[model samples]
Each structure stands twice: as structure tokens, then as C-alpha cells.
Target: MLIQYRRDIADLQQRIRNRRLQTFGLFGTPIALVATVAAGVGSKVVFWLHTEMPNPIVNTFTASAFILIAASVVQFWAEIGGEVWDDSGTSVRDLKLDLALAEERHILEARRHTAPTADRQASYKERLPPEIVRLRMESRHYRRLHLLMQWLLFISSAAISAVTAWYDPPQPAKGVLIGLGFTVTVITAATGYFKPRERAFNLQQTADAIEQHATAIELGIAPYNAPEEARNLELFATTVEGMRADQRMREQQLDQPQQGQQQVI
Candidate 1:
């Protein structure tokens, strides 16, 4: 029933990210970056001209560069922002409603549990199964490793894209560009084969499952509300292991070919 709301939330998050990037580009990229780059590059070009042809007047070229840079700076500040009030369908105000919907969904889930007190919950965590503790630690390690590798890949790829975009034909940066392009390609291929991101997500999902079950046990939620504590622990552990088994299956799916990845996970 809530799948549509989840999809809406995901879409909203993506749109929000894209909108923020666009806003940053409009605010900072055009005027400020151009002004800054022009000021530095113009001086270098003028110096090169003087070195190659002493007949050219360096002072005139320098003055023109300064004026051009100043103009860019002035123009940058003049048109820095767009309309203050947005009336679009996808405005930020509308996007935030997804968050409210998510909170409502959570409230519905929470209603299933017995009224759990903070103190009791903390005590319950203390008596959590040792196996879960180990699983949680393992999940954290996998999650952190994946996070680091993903950032490295993303940063490297984005750097290559920016460099490639800026590079023109017949330039000295050809060798550097080739090296970076090759490195990014190799890293991308390795990442895709190994599936570090998917592994991390699977591990994290398992961790969340464990935590949710633990919460149910702590709060005396259904099934965990059994009369015998031993039976409840047995059920909890069984449920957690089943969740981990599902996680392992997902990891195996990641190893399969792209065509196989289309099947429901």
C-alpha cells in the first residue's frame, strides 16, 4: 500500500538533489568561476605573448584582461539568483511533503508495538543476542568500506568528466587526459565486477532488519510478545538469521550478469 509513497519519496530525493545542483550552477558557476579563471588565465596568456613576441605591448593586454575580469565580477553579482518565490509543481515546499508522508508511514508501523519506554528499550539492547552484535559490527565494517570506495570512484569519475569537458583538441593535456580516462575506466570496471556498493547496501539492509526485530522484541510487539523469554529469543534469532540469509541471496544476485539483475530482488 505504501509502495507508491516510497517511490514518490525516492523521486523527490533525486529531484531535490538535481534542483540543488542547478541552483548552485546558476548561483556560482557562470559569473564567479569565469571571473576567477579569466583573471588568472588572462595574465598567463599575456606573459606568453610577451615571451614569444616582444613587439606586442604587455601593458595594453594586461589592462584589457583586468577590465574583462572586472566586468565578469560585476555581472556575476547582478544576476546571482532566480525568482525568490517558486510556484512550480515540483517546488521544494511540495517536495518536502514526501518526508511528512514517510513520517506518517513510520507512525503507522510504530503503532503495532506495545508502548515502549526509553529506559526499557535501553535495557533490552543490553541483553541483545551476541550473534546480532557480531552481525551489526560486520555490517558497519562493510558499510564503511563501501562508502569510502564509492566516494573515491565518484570523485575520480567526476574529475575525469570535468577535465575532459574543459580539454580541447591539440593540447598539452592529452597525455594527462588519457591517463585519467584509463584509470577511471579500470576503476569503474573493477567496481562493477566486485559490486562493493551493492554489498554495502545489502549489509546495511540486514543490519536495519536486525535492529527492527530487536525493537519489536524490546517493545513486546507481536510474535516477540510470547509468554516465554527463551521462546522469544529463539524466534528473534531465527527471524534475524532468515533476514541475513535473504541479504546473502541479494549479494549473490549482484554477482550475476546485468540481464539477470532485472529480476525482482
Candidate 2:
């Protein structure tokens, strides 16, 4: 049952991964196109509604605003895709770290009685140097890019708003202009708040697990050679198996109702 459950969970995870890739593959292009159109529309609107401003100034503001919005849209799409990629990267890293730690623990089990387990630990050395390095490089690179894009979005928005306020002044149409600015600001802030938190939370969970394992080992309660430690590993394995089983059950329940509803319809 545990084996079957693990298989099911693995299958579900693969499906989720594939679905995300497919979504980015299909929807990302359309999103970019839509953003391009949106930027063009914004430019046209500025040209039509705020005609009193000098041609060069208005054109400059329109260009800046549209470029900002279009860049934001592209950045936003990339951010979404980056989030999924980050999660996948973190998952892979966690798996590698866990496997390396587990192997270390396995070696310790075979040498608990020895005065030093260094010789036994030879087989348990880090196998994730390349994987870890690659992930770190990509992670840092993405973060730097994200920060730069964020500053660009902010500067562009502020420049556009400033130009709008100065040129358009407090006319009746000013209300409409301010409203658009406010709405975009609010939406951007709301998404920004949640997306970063979600990524941080996933990374934290893995870090916590690694810390827990280290602490247990340091206390000698989780020595690889001890019967108690082996029992603990068994229990931990069982718990993981149970979680996979529960996930499978949940998926089954979810699919069953959906299938039934579809059949009825």
C-alpha cells in the first residue's frame, strides 16, 4: 500500500510539473502579446485624451508610460514563470540535500561503534556540488534581475504619473487618470506581496527540515549505527509514506467528484 501510494504521489507531482510547463509554454506567449497590445492602447489613450501637452513632452510621457507598462507586463509574466522555476529548483535541491544527508546517516549507522566514522564517511561525501552551484548561480541571477525590473517599473510609473499630473492638471479627466494610476499601483502591490512570501515560505520549509536533521544527529539520538536511530529512520520513512498515501487519497476524492459531475452534465 505504501509503495502504491508513493507511486501515486510521484505521478501526481509529475503531472503538476508538466501542467505548469504547459501553462507557461502556451499562455506565456499570449500574455506577452496581450501586454504589447495593452501598452499600445495606453499610448493611444494618452495621445488622444491629453492632447494639450506639448507634442514632444506628451510623446515622451506616452513612450515612457507604454514602455513601462509593457515592460511590467513582460516582467510580471517572467516573474510568474520564475516563481514556478524557483520552486522546481528548490525541490530538486532539497531532494539532493536530503539524499546526501540520508547517505551520510546510513554510513554513520554502519560505524557508530567506531571511535571515528571519517573512513566510513568516505562514501557519503557531497555529490551535489555541481547541482548546488548551478542552483545558487541561477537563484542569485534571478534575484538581481527581479530587483532591476522592479526599480524600472517603479521609476517608469512615477515618471508617467508625474508627467500626467503636471501636463493634464486637475481637470475633469484628471479623476480618470488618477484612478487608473491608483488601480495599477494597488494590483501590483498586492501581487508583489504574495508572490515573494510564497517562494520564501517554500525555501524556509526545506531549511527547517535540514536543521532538524542536523540537530537530531548532533544529539547522538539519531546516530546512524544505533538501533534507536534506525527505528527513528523507519518511523520517519513511514510518516513520509503516510503523507504520500494521504495525498493520493485526496487526489482520488477530488477526481471522483469531478468525474461524477462531468458525467451528469
Candidate 3:
């Protein structure tokens, strides 16, 4: 059952990732391209209208330009409002909790399976720490990804700014660069605002706390130094429950809506 739960959570995460990619492919890239093209052609279009075009065609050209700009603005607003990558009616935090519950169930099963004999206690002892280790590793993975995205955005922004300043690009190219910069800024700001780094840190901290409690119980140390093996096992179970509760609280806090910002739902 725990394995099935893990698989389900993995599937859900993958679906979310794929949906985000699809959103980018269908809406993000095309809208950005349209905006860039409009920017690059804007100066020439204006020049042609004022100096080269016949007066009779000016109204039609102006109307077309206006429509393109208006459409681009609407697309940009939609992206900002999260219409492009909405989670398709699932709570990410709830999915994570479900995964955690699955892990807990697996641990309990391991304990029960090994409970019949003294010699088999080793199997039960070996069960939970590995799950904590996996959680820590997952947290580290997210931390690394968040850092990589931050660096990439920083480098891209700096490179774009430097090239524009040093090369003194034409007016149309300048407009395109400005649009690209705006897109990059939006991406960076969104990434930072979501705070993947903080999420990773919180996950790691919870794993560490759980692992410490488990270790103390295993070693027959303070707070878990119950005389009977059964009592110690009970302490271990309750410790895990308490740790999970703490973790859930932290996740709930993370999921809370920021002031003045309604949840996307």
C-alpha cells in the first residue's frame, strides 16, 4: 500500500510538471513570440505609416497594430493571473500529506511484521530511518533546483542587459530586448515568490527532527528509555505521529494565502 501511495504521488507530481510544460508550450512561448515580433516590427510599422504609406491605408494599419498590442497585453495579464498553469483542481499540499501517510503506514506494517520474535526486531529497527533519509534527499534535490533556477535567471538578465547597453541595438531590436527582459523578470519573480528554497528547508528540518527521535528510541536513550521493548515501541510510534503532525502544521502554514492575494483554486 505504501509503495502504491508513493507511485500515485509520483504520478501526480509528474502530471503537474507536464501540465506546466504544456502551459508554457501552448501559451507562454507563443505569447512571448508574438510580443517580441510586435515589438520588433513596431518602429518600422510606425515609420511606414507616417512617411511611406498612403493616407488611405493608415487607418487599417493602425487598427491592426492596436489589436495585436491589445491581445498581447491580455495574454500577459492572464499568465500573471495564473490562468495558464492552474493545478487542474488538486491541492499539492494534500497530495504531499497523503504520501507522508503512506510512508507512515509502511513503517507500521514493517513493525508488525517483525514483532513476533526478538531476532526479527532488526528488520523493524531498519525500516523508518531510510524513509527519513529519502525525505532529506528529496529536500536537497529541490534546494539544488531552486538555486540553479535563481542563477540561470540572474545570468540571463545580466547578459541581456549588458548586450543591449554595449552593442547599442537598433530601435526595433531594443523593443524586442525589452520585452524579453520583462518576460525573464516575470519568471524570476514568480519563482522567488513561490519560495521553493524555503519549502526544501522546512522538509529537511522535519526529516531531521524525526530521524533524531527515531535514533534516540533505537538507542534506548533519554525520553525513549522505557524499560520494556513494547513500551519503547509505543514511544516510537507516538514520536512518529507527533513528528508528522508538526510537519503537517508547517505545510499548512506554507499553504496559507498571502495578504491581499486570493488562492487560485
Best by lDDT: 3
The runs of at least 3 residues in candidate 3 whose Cα sits more than 4 Å from the true structure, single-residue gaps closed, are 1-126, 169-172, 260-265
Give every collision pair in model 1. none
lDDT of 2 at 238: 47
Q: Which candidate is the best by TM-score?
A: 3
User: TM-score rank, highest first?
Assistant: 3, 1, 2
lDDT score, residue 37, model 2?
A: 62
Model 1's lDDT to the true fold? 0.66
What's the TM-score of each model vs. the native?
A: 0.42, 0.29, 0.49
lDDT rank order = 3, 1, 2
User: Model 3 lDDT vs. the true structure?
Assistant: 0.68
lDDT values, one for every candidate: 0.66, 0.51, 0.68
Candidates 1 and 3 compared: the better one by TM-score is 3
Which is better, 1 or 3, measured by lDDT? 3
